[model samples]
Target: MYLTFWGVRGSYPVPGAATVRYGGHTSCVELRSDRGKCLVIDAGTGLRGLGKKLAQEFRKPDGATYNLILSHVHWDHIQGLPFFEPAYIGDTKIVVHAPRAAAKELRQVIGGITRHEFFPVDLDAVPADFEFHEVVPGSAFEIDEFTVLPIGLNHPFGAVGYRVDADGSSMAYVSDTAPFDRMLHKQHFTAGIEEPSDEDREILKTMRANLVESLREVDTVIYDTHFTSEEYEQFPHWGHSTPEHALQICQEAGVRQLVLYHHAPAHDDDMMDRIAEKFGLLGKEANVVVCVAKEKMTLTMGEVTNPGIVA
Candidate 1:
Protein backbone atom coordinates (compact mmCIF):
# COMPACT_ATOMS: atom_id res chain seq x y z
CA MET A 1 0.00 0.00 0.00
CA TYR A 2 1.22 3.50 -0.84
CA LEU A 3 0.04 6.33 1.46
CA THR A 4 0.89 9.86 0.41
CA PHE A 5 -0.05 13.10 2.10
CA TRP A 6 -1.19 15.89 -0.17
CA GLY A 7 -2.07 18.41 2.54
CA VAL A 8 -2.28 18.37 6.32
CA ARG A 9 -3.36 21.84 7.35
CA GLY A 10 -6.07 22.70 9.87
CA SER A 11 -8.84 25.33 9.85
CA TYR A 12 -7.77 27.04 6.62
CA PRO A 13 -5.06 27.26 4.00
CA VAL A 14 -1.99 29.26 4.86
CA PRO A 15 0.54 30.02 2.16
CA GLY A 16 3.61 32.17 2.86
CA ALA A 17 7.20 32.16 4.09
CA ALA A 18 6.33 31.13 7.65
CA THR A 19 4.37 28.09 6.54
CA VAL A 20 6.56 27.07 3.61
CA ARG A 21 8.26 24.25 5.47
CA TYR A 22 4.92 22.54 6.22
CA GLY A 23 4.11 23.09 2.53
CA GLY A 24 1.05 25.30 3.14
CA HIS A 25 -1.63 23.03 1.73
CA THR A 26 -5.01 22.30 3.20
CA SER A 27 -6.15 18.71 3.99
CA CYS A 28 -5.96 16.03 1.29
CA VAL A 29 -4.40 12.56 1.40
CA GLU A 30 -4.07 9.85 -1.23
CA LEU A 31 -3.67 6.13 -0.64
CA ARG A 32 -3.08 3.79 -3.55
CA SER A 33 -3.52 0.07 -3.06
CA ASP A 34 -0.96 -2.08 -4.82
CA ARG A 35 -3.72 -2.99 -7.25
CA GLY A 36 -3.82 0.63 -8.47
CA LYS A 37 -7.01 1.65 -6.65
CA CYS A 38 -6.86 5.34 -5.73
CA LEU A 39 -8.43 6.39 -2.43
CA VAL A 40 -8.39 10.13 -1.88
CA ILE A 41 -9.38 11.60 1.46
CA ASP A 42 -10.43 15.17 2.11
CA ALA A 43 -10.36 17.67 -0.76
CA GLY A 44 -8.64 20.67 0.76
CA THR A 45 -6.64 23.17 -1.29
CA GLY A 46 -3.78 20.73 -1.41
CA LEU A 47 -5.77 18.54 -3.82
CA ARG A 48 -5.17 21.13 -6.52
CA GLY A 49 -1.45 20.58 -6.31
CA LEU A 50 -1.91 16.83 -6.02
CA GLY A 51 -4.18 16.85 -9.07
CA LYS A 52 -1.48 18.70 -10.98
CA LYS A 53 1.05 16.08 -9.95
CA LEU A 54 -1.29 13.24 -10.92
CA ALA A 55 -1.79 14.81 -14.34
CA GLN A 56 1.97 14.74 -14.83
CA GLU A 57 2.56 11.19 -13.62
CA PHE A 58 -0.63 9.07 -13.83
CA ARG A 59 -2.71 10.35 -16.76
CA LYS A 60 -3.49 7.25 -18.83
CA PRO A 61 -5.36 6.74 -22.08
CA ASP A 62 -8.01 5.31 -19.80
CA GLY A 63 -9.20 7.70 -17.08
CA ALA A 64 -8.04 7.13 -13.50
CA THR A 65 -10.16 5.25 -10.95
CA TYR A 66 -10.60 7.32 -7.81
CA ASN A 67 -12.66 7.16 -4.60
CA LEU A 68 -13.01 10.08 -2.25
CA ILE A 69 -13.56 9.35 1.44
CA LEU A 70 -14.51 12.55 3.11
CA SER A 71 -14.11 13.18 6.85
CA HIS A 72 -16.67 15.93 6.71
CA VAL A 73 -17.56 18.93 4.60
CA HIS A 74 -15.76 21.59 6.58
CA TRP A 75 -14.33 24.24 4.30
CA ASP A 76 -10.73 23.38 5.03
CA HIS A 77 -11.47 19.71 4.37
CA ILE A 78 -13.58 20.00 1.22
CA GLN A 79 -12.94 23.43 -0.25
CA GLY A 80 -10.43 22.22 -2.79
CA LEU A 81 -12.75 19.78 -4.58
CA PRO A 82 -13.95 22.54 -6.86
CA PHE A 83 -10.39 23.26 -7.90
CA PHE A 84 -9.17 19.69 -8.44
CA GLU A 85 -8.57 19.57 -12.20
CA PRO A 86 -9.07 15.82 -12.48
CA ALA A 87 -12.59 16.10 -11.10
CA TYR A 88 -13.31 18.77 -13.70
CA ILE A 89 -11.96 16.82 -16.63
CA GLY A 90 -14.28 14.42 -18.45
CA ASP A 91 -11.79 11.56 -18.50
CA THR A 92 -11.37 11.18 -14.73
CA LYS A 93 -13.84 9.08 -12.73
CA ILE A 94 -14.49 10.01 -9.10
CA VAL A 95 -16.63 8.15 -6.57
CA VAL A 96 -17.31 10.37 -3.58
CA HIS A 97 -17.95 8.32 -0.47
CA ALA A 98 -19.06 10.44 2.43
CA PRO A 99 -21.31 10.25 5.50
CA ARG A 100 -24.63 8.98 4.22
CA ALA A 101 -26.66 11.10 6.62
CA ALA A 102 -24.69 14.13 5.59
CA ALA A 103 -24.13 13.68 1.87
CA LYS A 104 -26.19 16.81 1.43
CA GLU A 105 -24.01 18.50 4.01
CA LEU A 106 -20.94 17.44 2.06
CA ARG A 107 -22.38 18.77 -1.15
CA GLN A 108 -23.25 22.03 0.54
CA VAL A 109 -19.72 22.34 1.79
CA ILE A 110 -18.13 21.93 -1.62
CA GLY A 111 -20.89 23.89 -3.21
CA GLY A 112 -20.43 26.91 -0.97
CA ILE A 113 -16.93 27.62 -2.20
CA THR A 114 -17.81 27.12 -5.84
CA ARG A 115 -21.01 29.11 -5.89
CA HIS A 116 -20.97 32.13 -8.15
CA GLU A 117 -21.20 34.26 -5.00
CA PHE A 118 -17.82 33.05 -3.83
CA PHE A 119 -15.99 31.63 -6.87
CA PRO A 120 -16.53 31.78 -10.61
CA VAL A 121 -17.77 28.23 -11.13
CA ASP A 122 -20.79 26.28 -10.01
CA LEU A 123 -20.04 22.89 -8.50
CA ASP A 124 -22.73 21.26 -10.61
CA ALA A 125 -21.05 22.66 -13.68
CA VAL A 126 -18.00 20.44 -13.26
CA PRO A 127 -18.03 17.78 -15.98
CA ALA A 128 -16.01 15.03 -14.41
CA ASP A 129 -17.28 11.43 -14.52
CA PHE A 130 -18.63 11.60 -10.97
CA GLU A 131 -20.94 9.96 -8.44
CA PHE A 132 -21.56 10.39 -4.70
CA HIS A 133 -22.53 7.76 -2.16
CA GLU A 134 -23.29 8.11 1.53
CA VAL A 135 -21.36 5.65 3.64
CA VAL A 136 -22.48 4.23 6.98
CA PRO A 137 -20.36 4.52 10.10
CA GLY A 138 -18.76 1.40 11.58
CA SER A 139 -19.34 -0.25 8.24
CA ALA A 140 -16.42 -1.83 6.43
CA PHE A 141 -16.03 -1.70 2.67
CA GLU A 142 -13.62 -3.00 0.10
CA ILE A 143 -12.14 -1.73 -3.14
CA ASP A 144 -9.47 -3.90 -4.69
CA GLU A 145 -7.04 -4.77 -1.91
CA PHE A 146 -8.15 -2.25 0.68
CA THR A 147 -10.68 -2.71 3.48
CA VAL A 148 -11.85 0.46 5.21
CA LEU A 149 -13.31 0.51 8.72
CA PRO A 150 -15.12 3.71 9.53
CA ILE A 151 -15.65 5.23 12.96
CA GLY A 152 -17.60 8.35 13.82
CA LEU A 153 -15.61 11.10 15.58
CA ASN A 154 -16.53 13.86 18.00
CA HIS A 155 -16.66 17.20 16.21
CA PRO A 156 -19.25 19.94 16.37
CA PHE A 157 -19.81 19.78 12.64
CA GLY A 158 -19.64 15.93 12.72
CA ALA A 159 -16.80 13.83 11.27
CA VAL A 160 -15.57 10.28 10.76
CA GLY A 161 -12.15 8.66 10.95
CA TYR A 162 -10.92 5.88 8.72
CA ARG A 163 -8.86 2.80 9.43
CA VAL A 164 -7.75 1.44 6.11
CA ASP A 165 -6.15 -1.95 5.78
CA ALA A 166 -4.56 -2.66 2.43
CA ASP A 167 -3.13 -6.07 1.71
CA GLY A 168 -2.29 -6.70 5.39
CA SER A 169 -0.92 -3.16 5.93
CA SER A 170 -3.06 -0.80 8.01
CA MET A 171 -3.19 2.99 8.52
CA ALA A 172 -5.69 5.19 10.34
CA TYR A 173 -6.50 8.81 9.59
CA VAL A 174 -8.28 10.82 12.36
CA SER A 175 -8.23 14.57 12.09
CA ASP A 176 -10.10 17.74 13.16
CA THR A 177 -11.53 17.31 16.62
CA ALA A 178 -11.33 19.47 19.70
CA PRO A 179 -9.92 17.02 22.19
CA PHE A 180 -12.78 14.52 22.50
CA ASP A 181 -14.14 15.96 25.74
CA ARG A 182 -14.61 19.45 24.41
CA MET A 183 -16.68 18.52 21.39
CA LEU A 184 -19.35 16.79 23.44
CA HIS A 185 -19.65 19.55 25.94
CA LYS A 186 -19.12 22.57 23.80
CA GLN A 187 -20.28 25.05 26.47
CA HIS A 188 -17.68 23.81 28.93
CA PHE A 189 -14.80 23.13 26.57
CA THR A 190 -11.40 23.69 28.12
CA ALA A 191 -10.54 26.06 25.31
CA GLY A 192 -13.64 28.09 26.02
CA ILE A 193 -12.61 28.68 29.64
CA GLU A 194 -15.93 27.66 31.17
CA GLU A 195 -16.55 25.50 34.17
CA PRO A 196 -18.31 22.32 33.19
CA SER A 197 -21.63 21.62 34.77
CA ASP A 198 -21.86 18.14 36.31
CA GLU A 199 -23.99 17.08 33.39
CA ASP A 200 -21.55 18.61 30.96
CA ARG A 201 -18.63 16.84 32.60
CA GLU A 202 -20.46 13.52 32.43
CA ILE A 203 -21.31 14.09 28.80
CA LEU A 204 -17.72 15.01 28.11
CA LYS A 205 -16.50 11.86 29.83
CA THR A 206 -18.84 9.73 27.73
CA MET A 207 -17.78 11.41 24.54
CA ARG A 208 -14.11 11.15 25.44
CA ALA A 209 -14.56 7.45 26.07
CA ASN A 210 -16.21 7.03 22.67
CA LEU A 211 -13.45 8.97 20.94
CA VAL A 212 -10.81 6.90 22.67
CA GLU A 213 -12.56 3.74 21.62
CA SER A 214 -12.70 4.90 18.03
CA LEU A 215 -8.96 5.58 17.92
CA ARG A 216 -7.78 2.48 19.80
CA GLU A 217 -4.55 1.21 18.29
CA VAL A 218 -4.21 -0.45 14.90
CA ASP A 219 -0.87 0.32 13.25
CA THR A 220 -0.12 3.80 11.99
CA VAL A 221 -2.25 6.49 13.68
CA ILE A 222 -2.28 9.88 11.92
CA TYR A 223 -4.18 12.18 14.29
CA ASP A 224 -5.00 15.71 15.25
CA THR A 225 -2.04 17.25 17.08
CA HIS A 226 -2.16 20.73 15.74
CA PHE A 227 -1.59 22.63 18.97
CA THR A 228 0.60 22.49 22.05
CA SER A 229 -0.95 22.80 25.50
CA GLU A 230 0.32 26.38 25.55
CA GLU A 231 -1.25 27.27 22.22
CA TYR A 232 -4.61 25.76 23.11
CA GLU A 233 -5.22 28.76 25.33
CA GLN A 234 -5.98 30.97 22.35
CA PHE A 235 -8.37 28.68 20.55
CA PRO A 236 -9.59 26.33 23.19
CA HIS A 237 -12.95 25.42 21.69
CA TRP A 238 -12.05 25.66 18.04
CA GLY A 239 -11.69 21.85 17.69
CA HIS A 240 -8.00 20.87 17.65
CA SER A 241 -6.15 18.58 20.03
CA THR A 242 -2.85 19.23 21.78
CA PRO A 243 0.33 17.16 21.43
CA GLU A 244 0.35 16.30 25.10
CA HIS A 245 -3.24 15.08 24.92
CA ALA A 246 -2.46 13.27 21.68
CA LEU A 247 0.52 11.58 23.29
CA GLN A 248 -1.75 10.34 26.05
CA ILE A 249 -4.26 8.95 23.57
CA CYS A 250 -1.61 7.17 21.48
CA GLN A 251 -0.12 5.70 24.62
CA GLU A 252 -3.49 4.52 25.91
CA ALA A 253 -4.29 2.93 22.55
CA GLY A 254 -0.88 1.20 22.48
CA VAL A 255 -0.27 2.71 19.07
CA ARG A 256 2.86 1.47 17.34
CA GLN A 257 3.71 4.68 15.49
CA LEU A 258 2.08 8.07 15.76
CA VAL A 259 2.10 10.81 13.14
CA LEU A 260 1.17 14.25 14.50
CA TYR A 261 -1.09 15.70 11.83
CA HIS A 262 -3.22 18.82 11.04
CA HIS A 263 -0.54 21.42 11.73
CA ALA A 264 -1.36 24.96 12.77
CA PRO A 265 -0.71 27.63 10.16
CA ALA A 266 1.45 29.45 12.69
CA HIS A 267 4.00 26.66 12.90
CA ASP A 268 6.94 26.39 10.52
CA ASP A 269 8.70 23.22 9.39
CA ASP A 270 11.48 23.60 11.93
CA MET A 271 8.94 24.26 14.66
CA MET A 272 6.92 21.19 13.67
CA ASP A 273 10.10 19.12 13.65
CA ARG A 274 10.81 20.27 17.16
CA ILE A 275 7.26 19.45 18.19
CA ALA A 276 7.62 15.95 16.73
CA GLU A 277 10.82 15.42 18.67
CA LYS A 278 9.03 16.53 21.79
CA PHE A 279 6.31 13.98 21.13
CA GLY A 280 8.96 11.31 20.63
CA LEU A 281 10.35 12.06 24.06
CA LEU A 282 6.88 11.45 25.50
CA GLY A 283 6.52 8.03 23.85
CA LYS A 284 8.59 6.54 26.70
CA GLU A 285 10.76 4.30 24.55
CA ALA A 286 7.79 3.23 22.39
CA ASN A 287 7.98 3.43 18.59
CA VAL A 288 6.85 6.97 17.98
CA VAL A 289 7.36 9.04 14.82
CA VAL A 290 5.49 12.35 15.15
CA CYS A 291 6.46 14.24 12.07
CA VAL A 292 3.95 16.70 10.58
CA ALA A 293 2.85 15.56 7.09
CA LYS A 294 3.72 17.45 3.91
CA GLU A 295 2.50 17.58 0.31
CA LYS A 296 4.54 14.59 -0.84
CA MET A 297 5.65 12.67 2.25
CA THR A 298 4.88 8.99 1.72
CA LEU A 299 4.31 6.48 4.52
CA THR A 300 3.26 2.89 3.96
CA MET A 301 2.55 -0.29 5.91
CA GLY A 302 6.00 -1.61 5.01
CA GLU A 303 7.93 1.41 6.32
CA VAL A 304 6.60 1.13 9.89
CA THR A 305 8.06 -2.30 10.49
CA ASN A 306 11.27 -1.73 8.52
CA PRO A 307 14.50 -1.44 10.46
CA GLY A 308 14.64 0.04 13.96
CA ILE A 309 11.61 2.06 15.08
CA VAL A 310 12.98 3.50 18.30
CA ALA A 311 10.12 3.96 20.74
Candidate 2:
Protein backbone atom coordinates (compact mmCIF):
# COMPACT_ATOMS: atom_id res chain seq x y z
CA MET A 1 0.00 0.00 0.00
CA TYR A 2 1.08 3.54 -0.81
CA LEU A 3 -0.31 6.74 0.61
CA THR A 4 0.02 10.35 -0.46
CA PHE A 5 -1.09 13.56 1.13
CA TRP A 6 -2.56 15.90 -1.44
CA GLY A 7 -4.01 18.43 1.01
CA VAL A 8 -3.50 18.78 4.78
CA ARG A 9 -4.86 22.12 5.85
CA GLY A 10 -8.28 22.21 7.48
CA SER A 11 -11.27 24.59 7.42
CA TYR A 12 -10.37 26.34 4.12
CA PRO A 13 -7.63 26.93 1.59
CA VAL A 14 -4.90 29.33 2.66
CA PRO A 15 -3.04 30.24 -0.49
CA GLY A 16 -0.06 32.46 0.38
CA ALA A 17 3.67 32.39 0.92
CA ALA A 18 3.28 31.49 4.61
CA THR A 19 1.50 28.22 3.77
CA VAL A 20 3.46 27.24 0.67
CA ARG A 21 5.56 24.67 2.49
CA TYR A 22 2.82 22.55 4.02
CA GLY A 23 -0.11 23.23 1.66
CA GLY A 24 -2.89 25.69 0.90
CA HIS A 25 -5.61 23.23 -0.08
CA THR A 26 -8.07 21.57 2.26
CA SER A 27 -8.25 17.85 3.12
CA CYS A 28 -7.67 15.17 0.48
CA VAL A 29 -5.56 11.99 0.45
CA GLU A 30 -4.71 9.44 -2.21
CA LEU A 31 -4.21 5.76 -1.45
CA ARG A 32 -3.10 3.02 -3.78
CA SER A 33 -3.34 -0.69 -3.07
CA ASP A 34 -0.69 -3.19 -4.05
CA ARG A 35 -2.86 -4.28 -6.95
CA GLY A 36 -3.00 -0.68 -8.26
CA LYS A 37 -6.50 0.08 -7.09
CA CYS A 38 -6.88 3.82 -6.60
CA LEU A 39 -8.81 5.18 -3.63
CA VAL A 40 -9.25 8.84 -2.77
CA ILE A 41 -10.00 9.64 0.86
CA ASP A 42 -11.58 13.04 0.37
CA ALA A 43 -12.49 15.45 -2.46
CA GLY A 44 -11.21 18.73 -1.06
CA THR A 45 -9.46 21.49 -3.02
CA GLY A 46 -6.51 19.19 -3.62
CA LEU A 47 -8.64 16.83 -5.68
CA ARG A 48 -8.42 19.26 -8.57
CA GLY A 49 -4.69 18.72 -8.77
CA LEU A 50 -5.02 14.97 -8.32
CA GLY A 51 -7.61 14.87 -11.08
CA LYS A 52 -5.35 16.78 -13.46
CA LYS A 53 -2.46 14.43 -12.75
CA LEU A 54 -4.68 11.39 -13.16
CA ALA A 55 -5.91 12.68 -16.48
CA GLN A 56 -2.36 12.86 -17.70
CA GLU A 57 -1.14 9.57 -16.29
CA PHE A 58 -4.06 7.18 -16.05
CA ARG A 59 -5.29 5.92 -19.41
CA LYS A 60 -7.74 3.03 -19.84
CA PRO A 61 -9.39 2.21 -23.15
CA ASP A 62 -12.70 1.57 -21.40
CA GLY A 63 -12.64 4.21 -18.68
CA ALA A 64 -10.66 5.28 -15.66
CA THR A 65 -12.28 4.25 -12.39
CA TYR A 66 -11.79 5.94 -9.00
CA ASN A 67 -13.15 5.14 -5.56
CA LEU A 68 -13.74 8.24 -3.45
CA ILE A 69 -14.36 7.69 0.26
CA LEU A 70 -15.67 10.85 1.81
CA SER A 71 -15.37 11.52 5.53
CA HIS A 72 -18.26 13.95 5.45
CA VAL A 73 -20.03 16.53 3.30
CA HIS A 74 -18.48 19.68 4.72
CA TRP A 75 -17.48 22.28 2.16
CA ASP A 76 -13.79 21.79 2.83
CA HIS A 77 -14.22 18.07 2.24
CA ILE A 78 -16.32 18.03 -0.91
CA GLN A 79 -15.90 21.47 -2.47
CA GLY A 80 -13.57 20.28 -5.20
CA LEU A 81 -15.85 17.59 -6.62
CA PRO A 82 -17.19 19.90 -9.32
CA PHE A 83 -13.76 21.20 -10.20
CA PHE A 84 -12.24 17.70 -10.49
CA GLU A 85 -10.97 17.62 -14.08
CA PRO A 86 -11.41 13.87 -14.44
CA ALA A 87 -15.11 14.18 -13.68
CA TYR A 88 -15.45 16.17 -16.88
CA ILE A 89 -13.90 13.41 -18.95
CA GLY A 90 -16.32 11.32 -20.96
CA ASP A 91 -14.83 7.94 -19.95
CA THR A 92 -14.24 8.37 -16.25
CA LYS A 93 -16.13 6.36 -13.65
CA ILE A 94 -16.17 7.77 -10.11
CA VAL A 95 -17.71 5.89 -7.21
CA VAL A 96 -18.34 8.15 -4.23
CA HIS A 97 -18.94 6.54 -0.82
CA ALA A 98 -20.35 8.89 1.78
CA PRO A 99 -21.63 8.63 5.40
CA ARG A 100 -25.16 9.65 4.50
CA ALA A 101 -27.88 7.32 5.80
CA ALA A 102 -29.57 7.15 2.41
CA ALA A 103 -28.06 7.02 -1.05
CA LYS A 104 -30.57 9.55 -2.37
CA GLU A 105 -29.55 12.10 0.24
CA LEU A 106 -25.95 11.67 -0.71
CA ARG A 107 -26.81 12.34 -4.33
CA GLN A 108 -28.83 15.39 -3.31
CA VAL A 109 -25.92 16.81 -1.33
CA ILE A 110 -23.49 16.30 -4.18
CA GLY A 111 -25.97 17.62 -6.70
CA GLY A 112 -26.84 20.65 -4.60
CA ILE A 113 -23.24 21.80 -4.65
CA THR A 114 -23.02 21.57 -8.43
CA ARG A 115 -26.35 23.17 -9.16
CA HIS A 116 -26.63 25.81 -11.90
CA GLU A 117 -26.43 28.60 -9.33
CA PHE A 118 -23.05 27.46 -8.06
CA PHE A 119 -21.53 25.96 -11.19
CA PRO A 120 -22.16 26.31 -14.90
CA VAL A 121 -22.88 22.61 -15.37
CA ASP A 122 -25.25 20.57 -13.25
CA LEU A 123 -24.02 17.39 -11.59
CA ASP A 124 -26.20 15.31 -13.90
CA ALA A 125 -24.54 16.95 -16.86
CA VAL A 126 -21.06 15.93 -15.74
CA PRO A 127 -19.56 13.72 -18.44
CA ALA A 128 -18.35 11.01 -16.09
CA ASP A 129 -20.44 8.12 -14.85
CA PHE A 130 -21.00 8.89 -11.17
CA GLU A 131 -22.09 6.27 -8.64
CA PHE A 132 -23.02 7.27 -5.11
CA HIS A 133 -22.87 4.75 -2.29
CA GLU A 134 -24.12 5.38 1.24
CA VAL A 135 -21.84 3.95 3.86
CA VAL A 136 -23.13 3.34 7.36
CA PRO A 137 -20.85 4.07 10.23
CA GLY A 138 -19.44 1.00 12.04
CA SER A 139 -19.63 -1.11 8.90
CA ALA A 140 -16.86 -2.96 7.12
CA PHE A 141 -16.78 -3.15 3.32
CA GLU A 142 -14.44 -4.00 0.52
CA ILE A 143 -13.53 -2.16 -2.64
CA ASP A 144 -11.14 -3.92 -4.96
CA GLU A 145 -8.13 -5.01 -2.93
CA PHE A 146 -8.78 -2.77 0.05
CA THR A 147 -10.86 -3.69 3.09
CA VAL A 148 -12.35 -0.56 4.68
CA LEU A 149 -13.93 -0.16 8.08
CA PRO A 150 -15.84 3.05 8.79
CA ILE A 151 -16.32 4.26 12.35
CA GLY A 152 -18.40 7.13 13.62
CA LEU A 153 -16.62 10.27 14.72
CA ASN A 154 -17.69 13.06 17.08
CA HIS A 155 -18.59 15.88 14.72
CA PRO A 156 -21.62 18.15 14.56
CA PHE A 157 -23.17 16.74 11.40
CA GLY A 158 -21.54 13.35 12.07
CA ALA A 159 -18.39 12.05 10.34
CA VAL A 160 -16.74 8.73 9.59
CA GLY A 161 -13.19 7.59 10.09
CA TYR A 162 -11.77 4.90 7.85
CA ARG A 163 -9.32 2.08 8.50
CA VAL A 164 -8.08 0.55 5.26
CA ASP A 165 -6.13 -2.65 5.04
CA ALA A 166 -4.45 -4.25 2.06
CA ASP A 167 -1.39 -6.37 1.33
CA GLY A 168 -0.68 -6.97 5.02
CA SER A 169 -0.52 -3.23 5.65
CA SER A 170 -3.10 -1.12 7.45
CA MET A 171 -3.73 2.61 7.70
CA ALA A 172 -6.28 4.56 9.65
CA TYR A 173 -7.65 7.96 8.69
CA VAL A 174 -9.24 9.66 11.73
CA SER A 175 -10.24 13.18 10.83
CA ASP A 176 -12.73 15.77 12.18
CA THR A 177 -13.15 14.41 15.70
CA ALA A 178 -12.85 16.00 19.09
CA PRO A 179 -11.10 14.36 21.99
CA PHE A 180 -13.50 12.33 24.05
CA ASP A 181 -13.64 14.71 26.94
CA ARG A 182 -16.08 13.97 29.73
CA MET A 183 -16.58 17.66 30.38
CA LEU A 184 -18.21 18.08 26.99
CA HIS A 185 -21.11 15.94 28.14
CA LYS A 186 -21.64 17.73 31.43
CA GLN A 187 -24.79 19.33 30.14
CA HIS A 188 -26.53 15.97 30.13
CA PHE A 189 -26.04 15.53 33.87
CA THR A 190 -26.34 17.66 36.97
CA ALA A 191 -23.81 20.46 37.11
CA GLY A 192 -22.79 19.71 40.69
CA ILE A 193 -21.83 16.11 39.96
CA GLU A 194 -18.10 15.75 40.50
CA GLU A 195 -17.88 12.70 38.24
CA PRO A 196 -19.88 11.29 35.38
CA SER A 197 -22.59 8.73 36.09
CA ASP A 198 -21.78 5.07 35.65
CA GLU A 199 -23.58 4.96 32.32
CA ASP A 200 -21.82 8.05 31.02
CA ARG A 201 -18.46 6.71 32.08
CA GLU A 202 -19.15 3.43 30.36
CA ILE A 203 -20.12 5.21 27.18
CA LEU A 204 -16.92 7.22 27.13
CA LYS A 205 -14.85 4.14 27.82
CA THR A 206 -16.49 2.24 24.99
CA MET A 207 -15.94 5.13 22.59
CA ARG A 208 -12.23 5.28 23.27
CA ALA A 209 -11.91 1.50 23.23
CA ASN A 210 -13.63 1.28 19.88
CA LEU A 211 -11.39 3.93 18.37
CA VAL A 212 -8.27 2.24 19.67
CA GLU A 213 -9.42 -1.10 18.37
CA SER A 214 -9.95 0.33 14.92
CA LEU A 215 -6.37 1.66 14.88
CA ARG A 216 -4.66 -1.16 16.72
CA GLU A 217 -1.30 -2.11 15.21
CA VAL A 218 -1.90 -0.03 12.10
CA ASP A 219 1.18 0.86 10.10
CA THR A 220 0.12 4.48 9.71
CA VAL A 221 -2.51 6.60 11.37
CA ILE A 222 -3.39 9.94 9.80
CA TYR A 223 -5.21 11.77 12.58
CA ASP A 224 -6.81 15.16 13.04
CA THR A 225 -4.51 17.53 14.87
CA HIS A 226 -6.14 20.82 14.14
CA PHE A 227 -5.16 22.49 17.39
CA THR A 228 -2.62 22.65 20.16
CA SER A 229 -3.67 21.72 23.68
CA GLU A 230 -4.10 25.37 24.57
CA GLU A 231 -6.16 26.04 21.47
CA TYR A 232 -8.30 22.95 22.03
CA GLU A 233 -9.15 24.12 25.53
CA GLN A 234 -10.73 27.28 24.13
CA PHE A 235 -12.68 25.48 21.42
CA PRO A 236 -13.58 22.26 23.15
CA HIS A 237 -16.67 21.76 21.02
CA TRP A 238 -15.01 22.58 17.70
CA GLY A 239 -14.85 18.93 16.67
CA HIS A 240 -11.08 18.78 16.30
CA SER A 241 -8.20 17.19 18.18
CA THR A 242 -4.81 18.38 19.36
CA PRO A 243 -1.36 16.95 18.77
CA GLU A 244 -1.26 15.88 22.41
CA HIS A 245 -4.51 14.03 21.99
CA ALA A 246 -3.26 12.38 18.81
CA LEU A 247 -0.06 11.25 20.49
CA GLN A 248 -2.00 9.81 23.38
CA ILE A 249 -4.27 7.85 21.08
CA CYS A 250 -1.40 6.56 18.96
CA GLN A 251 0.47 5.47 22.02
CA GLU A 252 -2.54 3.70 23.42
CA ALA A 253 -3.34 1.96 20.17
CA GLY A 254 0.26 0.81 19.64
CA VAL A 255 0.34 2.28 16.18
CA ARG A 256 3.73 2.20 14.52
CA GLN A 257 3.38 5.58 12.84
CA LEU A 258 1.20 8.62 13.37
CA VAL A 259 0.76 11.43 10.88
CA LEU A 260 -0.53 14.67 12.43
CA TYR A 261 -2.93 16.02 9.86
CA HIS A 262 -5.81 18.48 9.23
CA HIS A 263 -3.74 21.49 10.13
CA ALA A 264 -5.42 24.66 11.30
CA PRO A 265 -5.73 27.26 8.57
CA ALA A 266 -4.09 29.95 10.69
CA HIS A 267 -0.99 27.90 11.50
CA ASP A 268 1.90 29.01 9.31
CA ASP A 269 4.98 27.11 8.27
CA ASP A 270 7.02 28.25 11.24
CA MET A 271 4.33 27.15 13.67
CA MET A 272 4.06 23.84 11.90
CA ASP A 273 7.81 23.38 12.01
CA ARG A 274 7.82 23.98 15.75
CA ILE A 275 4.94 21.58 16.27
CA ALA A 276 6.64 18.93 14.19
CA GLU A 277 9.90 19.29 16.04
CA LYS A 278 8.16 19.06 19.42
CA PHE A 279 6.10 16.02 18.47
CA GLY A 280 8.97 14.39 16.67
CA LEU A 281 10.89 14.41 19.93
CA LEU A 282 7.86 13.14 21.82
CA GLY A 283 7.32 10.34 19.32
CA LYS A 284 10.95 9.34 19.54
CA GLU A 285 10.67 9.10 23.29
CA ALA A 286 7.50 6.98 23.01
CA ASN A 287 8.84 4.77 20.22
CA VAL A 288 6.26 5.83 17.68
CA VAL A 289 7.08 7.26 14.29
CA VAL A 290 5.54 10.71 13.91
CA CYS A 291 5.38 13.28 11.12
CA VAL A 292 3.31 16.25 10.10
CA ALA A 293 1.37 15.77 6.91
CA LYS A 294 2.56 17.88 3.96
CA GLU A 295 1.14 18.30 0.53
CA LYS A 296 2.64 15.91 -2.06
CA MET A 297 4.29 13.84 0.66
CA THR A 298 4.25 10.13 -0.09
CA LEU A 299 4.82 7.13 2.18
CA THR A 300 5.35 3.63 0.89
CA MET A 301 4.23 0.91 3.28
CA GLY A 302 7.03 -1.10 4.92
CA GLU A 303 9.68 1.33 3.68
CA VAL A 304 9.71 3.51 6.82
CA THR A 305 10.01 1.84 10.22
CA ASN A 306 11.40 4.55 12.47
CA PRO A 307 10.19 7.67 14.26
CA GLY A 308 10.99 10.50 11.83
CA ILE A 309 9.66 12.71 9.08
CA VAL A 310 9.00 11.17 5.67
CA ALA A 311 9.92 14.27 3.72
In model 2, what lDDT does residue 9 have?
A: 89
The digit string of per-residue lDDT tens for model 2 on 221-263 reads 9999999999887776667899888889999899999999999
Q: Which ranges in model 2 have alpha carbons more than 4 Å from their true place?
A: 101-104, 182-202, 303-311
**Candidate 2 backbone clash number:** 0
Model 1 Cα RMSD, 1 decimal: 4.2
Candidate 2 lDDT at 267 equals 97
What is the overall TM-score of model 2 with all chains considered together? 0.90
Q: Candidate 1's error at 303, in angstroms?
A: 6.7
Against the hidden reference, what TM-scores do the models get?
0.85, 0.90
The whole-model C-alpha lDDT of candidate 2 against the native structure comes to 0.85
Whole-model lDDT per candidate: 0.73, 0.85
Residue-pair clashes per prediction, in order, are 4, 0
Segments in model 1 whose C-alpha atoms lie over 4 Å from true places: 57-61, 100-105, 183-207, 284-287, 303-311
Cα miss at 67, model 2 (Å)?
0.4
